[model samples]
Target: MPPRIPVSEAQIDRVVAQFYQRVRAHPALGPVFAGHVADWPVHEEKIGRFWRNALLVQRCYDGNPMQVHRAAGDVKAQHFPVWLSIFDAVLAEELPQHLAQAWSALAHRIGRGLSFGLPQTDDADPVPYLG
Candidate 1:
């Protein structure tokens, strides 16, 4: 079994809400998200489900984040860093220190995995070997 991540559903929902709020305000990230996300509330709820599944080991979320991002056509590999930065900030703001740190570590690992799947731009360098 996957190790259970210590977090509450409320914390997951709060972090997702705050993170997306920051994302919508971010100049670079906002435009990219705006192009894809039409209804903010629905998107937030789906993300909340994703976090619940990820942290709480629930079977609620049924979406392919990688496929969704890839099909969006504008989700570049470079965007993951900025996205994770925003998420880390939100996690720090909304969660206790220990919880925030733990979640951030997991998030960064997931973000790197997701970023690797994204197509590289001509101007971007090759992704480094992690193994």
Candidate 2:
């Protein structure tokens, strides 16, 4: 195994920012996310904590992600697989393999652990282009 790269808060912030931007800009998902997010800065902070806790063995997060996604109502179950795929892509270039596997596993776990109403077949995770 490769040495575990120490991920900083800033790096996680950048990843979440990039991911959220792709989600917001996605044609299928853009409108669904509009106005629903309410506070980007706050969400950014929350995601920073989320990623930190997610990568580490800490359990600082008090709430459940399934509930958050359920409330988001913008994303459905099918969207998760693609989201995982896209997220892995981001990690593939930026994060190391172990980190990539960890993130991907988290996404997969989230996908299996949650479900929404009848999913729309057309909705898919947007391809992230961090340009």
Candidate 3:
């Protein structure tokens, strides 16, 4: 079993960048993100901080992701699957198998956190991947 992969801010930023590269080209989520993440770099930094803090317990940033996801009403339940899939693809392609699994679990957790309107830190079902 893959011991939990250690995640850092830089890693989170890389993952977010890779994920968005694909997401921006996606028909379902691209336009939506494009409309808002105009300052893509800034958005990346913000999100990097969000994930770093949320997943790794780093005190880097603060933002209610649940509210953001809720506001992203366009980001339906199906989107979570796509997100996880893309995330899995990215990690598996870039990181080792062990790291990939760890990242997948975390990504799925993030999805479930949003799916049920709770942070991934709280209890919830594991997320499944699909990208």
Which pairs clash in the backbone of model 1? none
Put the candidates in TM-score order, highest first: 1, 3, 2
Superposing all C-alpha atoms, what RMSD in Å does each candidate have to the true structure? Answer: 4.9, 9.2, 8.8
* TM-scores for all predictions: 0.88, 0.70, 0.77
Instruction: Specify the poorest-scoring 10-residue window by lDDT in model 2.
Output: 1-10
Better of 2 and 3 by TM-score: 3
lDDT of 3 by residue, 18-120 (tens): 9889988988778878766779888888988777776677777878887887776455666677778887898887777876787788778878877776333
Off by over 4 Å in 1: 1-3, 122-131
Cα-lDDT of candidate 3: 0.74
Give candidate 2's error at residue 48 in angstroms. Answer: 1.8
Best by TM-score: 1
Error of 2 at 94 (Å): 1.8
- In model 2, the Cα lDDT at residue 23 comes to 74
CA lDDT, candidate 3, residue 79:
67
